[model samples]
Target: MTEYHGNVHVGGPVQTHELPQLMITKVAVGPMDNNAYLLRCRQTDEQVLIDAANEAGTLLRVIGSGGLARVITTHRHGDHWQALAEVVERTGATTVAGRYDAEGIDVPTDELLDDGDRIGVGQSTLEVIHLVGHTPGSIALLYDDPKGPPHLFTGDSLFPGGVGNTRGNAENFTSLINDVEAKLFARLPDETWVYPGHGADTTLGKERPSLPEWRARGW
Candidate 1:
């Protein structure tokens, strides 16, 4: 396979990164360029879908006949779940979202997550980290690989350049930045890989130096 640079466009080819026990396939969907991740466990063949953003047909095609075990909505954002209901209906995948944002989504959340909760994917597991401000119930998932570097799936709370947009609310921005700094930057190593809800992927080390700049700009 070609090198996975984590760069994808709405109509472009999907990108995939394989690990010892997991395989992560990322595709750009919807006009907003939302990114949906398909995580499959090599050990158990169980799969999970992150943010069924849009284009149900394409997503279902990618899912194939195997279907999915669970579908996790990153937040309550409309763009993040345009295809959620359909995907769940077709696959019978358990719905998961943050505890606080659960009510905002149209579909019922079968699993409500909080900080420090663990989601099982067959034999593999993902640790949830609740991030406030970008939306009260925003979350980021951590997959700490024993053989290699760690991987993070940040819904809308984090991105490559700075943190996610807080819609000009000073309090929200402050809360978001603080949580990102304390919960994410302060804990994870520089080598951790970050996968955002949209756009390209970035490593924690690459964005660490610019945290101060982001705060100064105050977006």
Candidate 2:
């Protein structure tokens, strides 16, 4: 069993975590050091790629020959979809993105995701969460593992120290923080693992205590 810590860097080795029914592979790519995740079903081998964030060759190499069912762009951010067109073209995978930010994505989104939507990867299911502020249509994915801790793929919404950037807009910051608190912090447990779009992974418990500070700082 390969120990999966979820700590990845550009040009570093990929880390894959094995759950009872699912396999999660994480890699860091692109100049921005964007993190891309590959979720595979142990039973059916069906797979989904989260954020084909740059390095089409690297992403394709990670994807391999098994092929991809869908590519979910967490948000419309350019960095997150830098390799979208190429990945989709090569894999012929269905493109999925948030409803509001779908227009911002360069490629056509086959499916427009909304809050409470469910996506399937073979036997496992990922719940869609619409988080505003970072982007009007930014989204996060929650995979409640049956045998282990819940996993969350947060695009640019929730990070380790604070929520994603909202620029100088107070309203956007407020919306992002509020949604994160009510939807993520309040609803999920501390053991939930968070896989952010960039940087290292963090648990909800590690970031829970500082929620108040994040709100008070108002950045």
Candidate 3:
């Protein structure tokens, strides 16, 4: 049986937070307890939905009556996109995914993102960081917050306890750890917020010290 946090539920109240010019709304969905995020631009109200994981009706309601401008799939994982087709078809939102993972997804991708690509979210934008290993094209979105620490949408590339599963392969694990340390830990500050594809949120500061342990354990 899948365990879920107390806050994870259908029709759950959205957890909202302000990040400079962007407003983030997070909701947990699906049997796997995938987290779907709705990022709205404060200046223009243009919104983007990340990983419409499951429960299409709940996601549709979460977007409210305004609808969405684009739906971004974090990777090619089926669970991460169980609701993608429905949500996009219903809202007519443009679909975006990493260039390497686009062909694997069932939905047609409107935009192919690469590392250093900037996705405009009203006045602000999200920087794409393509992290390899768990999937060939797993990407994370970074938002630099002027008022506070930066925010990262890591998808399944990262989680609270450690990096996402690498199919128990040493090479894959090495690749993920290296990319995460170099691209994320080295580049971003410790206060950066990590919102993963599943489970509760965690901070880079909290997880940084455990890097060596994760390496030794070979997860």
Candidate 4:
């Protein structure tokens, strides 16, 4: 709801300090202000970039500071992938995206990720969960640590107050709703933190209370 610099909207600044050991920093990009995340494994200095978008200059600044290892796309949205080639060219890091989105970027995704797949950055590992509603190959990244609240990075699928807009044949709103309710909501702990592609960062518990409202409103 809070728009910063035209495209970047933020409900709040990321709690990067909270995950100090992981050294995770999320940078907002594009006209929609999509988020591209930079995560560094504090112990080994390994890093990864997630969802590279319009803010290449800014993203590079963060990556340069932290040191980048790989680039990973969450879905096929042009806003999220357009600046990716630049990112790859600059960082020399391999790119990973869902098979469907990979072709659009013209880079053979070094790894085609699917549900239950794991992506590791130094010591921290992320679990890939495919939530195929907004796009056929849409995915979310789930990171749960013993010391901190679990985090879910939902790409263009689920947001703070609503779900992503389904503009293509690849989407089925009802099915997406079902998956969010039965799969994501049912499985994740109530205290889990959700950092969506756009809008604010919210908690599973905070958002779950309004599932019925969203369903009733036809989202």
Candidate 5:
């Protein structure tokens, strides 16, 4: 487990990042241990939840009295949205998903996200980056902080060790790798922080050198 800024707990509130204008909380839920993140804009108190994977009760508790502005699903994968319906119904938060995969989700999408679309979180804005291959509409959110390195929520497209599984399809693997390289690596700085759908977080700097290896392994 990666050491966050504050104390960490399983299926419990964890203050992962705190800045003057932004705050992030993470909780691991469901059998797959999917990570659900609550990103709050401190200045405006508006917030967004990323991947409401499961454990509605825990997620609700973590949300507390804060008003949830939106719930953004990174992809259409079942595991990434097990608790999405419950969460949306309970909070009445608008649900956002990529257009291509929106239809596949059980819940009706309130908004269709596209590449380059900007999502507001209080005073800050998250730039949506559509990285296809993991899913036709898989998207990642990029938060660029003026104070320091930028933050990236990659969903299942990119992980600490390598890219997400291509399901043994060479074309899919190639597409994912190309998107990661063109849309992410070639543009973003190495200091960018990567938060995935499941498991631990990692920095782009730490994973950049392994691109060749990842390609060689054909994952």
Candidate 6:
């Protein structure tokens, strides 16, 4: 059974939820209300923060309380990459990002992950898949949960009602669609739960059948 541990709306801004055992905290940051996650292994207290935007203090506070181990970036967009350096310096944790967009983030990435690299946090090991198009070096985190359905952290690459915005010159809308259809939709089970960078949590089953619609709409 899935349990929600926290729903703290820091400063009446956005709702942040912490799911224990999983030790994951989802913080909504930035003017766009982007969600940055702080995940920790309950058993080991080793934590990881994904996507840093505004609220450097809040991010640091969450990490300090959770005992953060590292920070990981999904892409190089300013919304997700802005607070990365500060978080890294404050937490004293290594940063990891996709090889292609790594340079754009400007922080030194201790490890550059490719299509299929496994990263361990606490007891769970997450498999990283290169889901480019949103950015040349974007990656998605996939993990199999024994107690619950598997999860895919699609970064800015995939969302609840739609995929990520591909407005940048470096972004390819067509390639973004193709990557989601092939990498995300094809591999994971329809029941797999998705934790996107923005908006509400959704299941793969809810988003799959509408792929053609998303494609037709030109997202």
Candidates sorted by lDDT, best first: 2, 1, 5, 3, 6, 4
Model 1 lDDT tens row, 1-219: 888889999988889998899999999997899999999999888999999999998899778887699999999999999999999999999999999999999999999999999998778899999999999999999999989999999988999898999999999999999999999999999999999999999999999999999999996
lDDT per prediction?
A: 0.93, 0.96, 0.88, 0.76, 0.89, 0.78
- What TM-score does candidate 2 reach? 0.99
**1-219, model 2: which lDDT tens digit per residue?**
779999998998999988899999999997999999999999999999999999999999999999999999999889999999999999999999999999999999999999999999999999999999999999999999988889999999988899999998999999999999999999999999999999989999999999999999997
Give the distance in Å from residue 165's predicted Cα in candidate 6 to where it truly belongs: 1.5
Q: What ranges in model 3 sit over 4 Å off?
A: 1-7
Q: Model 4: which ten-residue window has the lowest total lDDT?
A: 1-10
Best by lDDT: 2
Better of 2 and 4 by lDDT: 2
lDDT of 5 by residue, 1-219 (tens): 454743334655565587667888878886887888999998888989999888888888888898799999999999988899889888999999998999989999999999999999989999999998999999999999988899999999999899998899999999999999999999999989888888888889999999999999999
lDDT of 3 by residue, 1-219 (tens): 223222445556667766568988889886888889999999899989999899998899889887799999999999989999999989999999999999989989999999999898778788999999899999999999877889999999988888989998889899999999899999888899889998788889999999899889988
- What TM-score does each of the candidates earn? 0.99, 0.99, 0.94, 0.87, 0.95, 0.88
CA RMSD of each candidate after superposition: 0.7, 0.7, 3.7, 4.1, 2.1, 2.9
Give me the displacement of residue 5 in model 6, in angstroms. Answer: 11
lDDT (Cα) of model 5: 0.89
lDDT of 6: 0.78
Model 4: per-residue lDDT, tens digit, 118-163?
A: 9998999999888767877888888877587787888888887877
Stretches of candidate 1 above 4 Å error? none
Reference-based lDDT, residue 58, model 2: 98
Any residue pairs clashing in model 2, and if so which?
A: none
Distance (Å) between predicted and true CA of 178, model 3?
0.4
